[model samples]
Target chain A: MTRQELFEQIKIKQSFLCVGLDTDLNKIPSHLQKVADPIFEFNKQIIDQTADFAVAYKPNIAFYEALGPKGWESLQKTLDYIPKNIFSIADAKRGDIGNTSGLYAKAFFETMDFDSITVAPYMGIDSVSPFLSYENKWVILLALTSNEGSLDFQFSELKNGKPVYQEVLEKSSKWGNPDNMMYVVGATRGEKIGEVRKIVPEHFFLVPGVGAQGGSLEEVAKYGMNSRCGLLVNSSRGIIYAGKGTDFGTEARKEAKKLQGEMEVLLNQYCY
Target chain B: MTRQELFEQIKIKQSFLCVGLDTDLNKIPSHLQKVADPIFEFNKQIIDQTADFAVAYKPNIAFYEALGPKGWESLQKTLDYIPKNIFSIADAKRGDIGNTSGLYAKAFFETMDFDSITVAPYMGIDSVSPFLSYENKWVILLALTSNEGSLDFQFSELKNGKPVYQEVLEKSSKWGNPDNMMYVVGATRGEKIGEVRKIVPEHFFLVPGVGAQGGSLEEVAKYGMNSRCGLLVNSSRGIIYAGKGTDFGTEARKEAKKLQGEMEVLLNQYCY
Candidate 1:
């Protein structure tokens, strides 16, 4: 999706909520387990109910991959079911050498038709530059991830006094414009959102670590929002696994709506 | 495979050569295209020819993923065909949050039964630790890659005077022992191999960029080899796609045998 298109979705929906479809077969509603593909069935319901509130759907690829080829099929079905207007993210943290990365870009962007894919920036420019070649597809590079391991290498101090994540934000920004590039900034660190904005203010931030990960929507919007509503606060388990029963889909919609209601207020306060 | 089993394979074959199965459908000989599942057919022939010389078979996952579900089926057949004694590396640079990383571990290790998988270390400890839980499996972490982009972040200087890759080596070595952990050190920079050996002297290094990427096998063995002949020098295009003809399998075997011959001499000089 284009930058203007994404901004329009956020404005129209009154939320920058990107619902994470990190679907796990064991975690889905028990009643759906008997269906041909439980994960896809669960996702189909969730998307059907919550599409009104969510601006995007980010499928965590690892969950599908664990089930082997069957999992990939389920993912394809889920992707096909999601409305085109809602941005689709293949939250697969993939990057490799240039040629290999080209294949990955083909896998996620062309074959699967995802609007974007999360890419790890450790291998540098050639590893990431392939994804930027696709018009309207974004490469959401990993910056300050919410995981504890993010502290290991990403936050290491550079000689020039910038942390490695800052170096990533500064250097990688030159590779692609704001339209084709975004950064994955963990919402757990609200202040770091402001810190990341200082480096690249115009770029969107795909913020994970809200809800189940205990990040506040108010703090995230206060620090991370830009004029274009440059924050996609994601909630996976908190929203999708909210009440695993026959009415699981309805419960998920309720959870998404609650988050969206808050996001609407944040959008009015910060972006407007 | 255990570290001891790998070293034994190196000694038995008198070669530490790893053949990368980065099979690109477009690049393979046109004659093979007539066959059903040409990628797998090509890999089957190549594996049949070169299995005698190669200690490990590393399939670049992106190449298969680009083809979608059918490609994954080909990969499954190829994996099942590889000799049990020979180590298999899924050259899939995958890492995520802890729970998600566990699914990835199940995908590659438990489900696919790959002996090892290459993981990018940018996410830190939790993202890496899940892959270490499997017995006799390996987590070949990316240290120095053989791409131009390697210069971007892998070489970032830390305040303590060590490079970012060194910090990765020092910190990550604590997460898993040399038995279960190896590092992907690009053969492009021969001198960096020596520098890496200084930090973790006993660990095995999966060295890529030898033939196709202009890296010298002689220099890699000189500085990188340790008591166990600690290196798996990979040559993908150089060996697999040596000649695009009906006789491509024979040509691939010749290339692999030539590398294995050089590796035998290196073993005599360095390990024995």
Candidate 2:
């Protein structure tokens, strides 16, 4: 899906929240464990309960992958369960050779039906171009991440006088336009989001690390929000596994509503 | 698996070849298509025929993930089909937040049961350290990729007067010792392999871009080979889908043998 369509969905739903489906079998309540696919069951409930409050569902590939074959089946089911208007992301973080990446594009876009897939840009353009080739598909490339270790290489000053992450943002921008591409600038790096904004103000930013990761949503919105409300703030543990009991779905909805409410305030402040 | 164990496997097999199980459904013969899972079937046969000759089997995750839930199922079966002694890699190129990355560690190492997995170091230490937490498991960080676009950022000079690829190799080396870490230095970048070896002489290197990618194995071996035969030369399409007819397995085996034969000679010259 194009970025504009995603923006419209967010506006219509009055939410910019992307509920992360990092569902873990071990973390789910034991009551649901008896279900054939507990991961899918959990995802289904989460989607059903929180669909109205969330504009996107980001299913982390690793969680489903941990269950082996059964986990994958659950992931597919979860993707199918998500509403058509909501953006679905296979947070796979995949990138490889050109031919191999093309096959990956087919896997996520053509076969399983996800609107977007997160890609690691370390392999350079060839690995990312394959994903970009799909019409209307999005490539969320890693820029400045939230982790403390991000200071190691990403912030390292390059010979060209720019930091490594900035260089990646500048170079990768040429591969695809803002409509087909996005950058993952972690919300935890609130101070630096302004620096990131200067690089690509038009592209949407998939901002994670809010809530449970200690990133302030207020700070991220203040510094990172553009005219288009260019942010998809994700909160996995904070939203999905909020209550952890029989009323988990209700609690999830409440948590999503809280985030959406905050997002609405941000959107209004940014004149969206 | 530990680097010592991987080296022993190479010596026992008298080859440093790592057959890339990049099984593409479209590339497999029609006869295999009738199987329950064509990708898994092809991988099983390839593993069986080449297990005695190859030191490792690198399954690029894009290939498996492209098939969706079924592809992941095939990946699990292929992992099971590989001999216990040979090194197995889930080339997923994953790197994310610390907590999420910990789950990724569990997915590949604890759940899916791979000896190693490819990672993109662009996210820096937090993105990579979670993978290193797994004892004896390897994190094959992308160093120098073999693609035209690799020149975009990887070769851009860093403020430390080193290229970004060199900076990644140098910094990431501090996170894990050579025994638990490796870097992917593309085989096509033979000239720079010598430079990479200078920085990461102890860690093993997973070199792709051989065979179909037009990378010279001899040049790679000459410059990149370390004292322990520290190179996992991967040939994906050129070896796995050598022929498209019913004798695909036989053809695959023949193609793998040709690479192994060359690897055997390289091993002798370097190790002895």
lDDT of each: 0.94, 0.86
Tens digits of lDDT, candidate 2, A1-272: 77878889988987889999989877898899998888888899999999999988999987777677687788888889999999888898888778878988998898888999999887788989999888888998888888887888888897778888888899899999898888889887677998898889898889989998889999998899898888898999999889888889999999999999999988999746
- Candidate 2 has an lDDT of 0.86
Provide C-alpha RMSD values for all models, in order: 0.7, 1.8
State the lDDT of candidate 2 residue by residue for B1-272, as single tens digits: 77788888888888888888877777788898898888888888888777777889998887777777777788888898888899998888888777778888888998788999998887788889988988889899999988877888888887768888888898899999998999999877678998999998888999988998889999999998988988998988887778788777788889888888888899888766
DockQ of 1: 0.92
TM-score of chain B of each: 0.99, 0.97
Model 1 compared with the native: what TM-score? 0.99
Which CAPRI tier for candidate 1? Answer: high
Backbone collision tally, model 1: 0
Candidate that would win on DockQ: 1
Off by over 4 Å in 2: none
The true-versus-predicted C-alpha distance at residue A257 of model 2, in Å, is 1.8
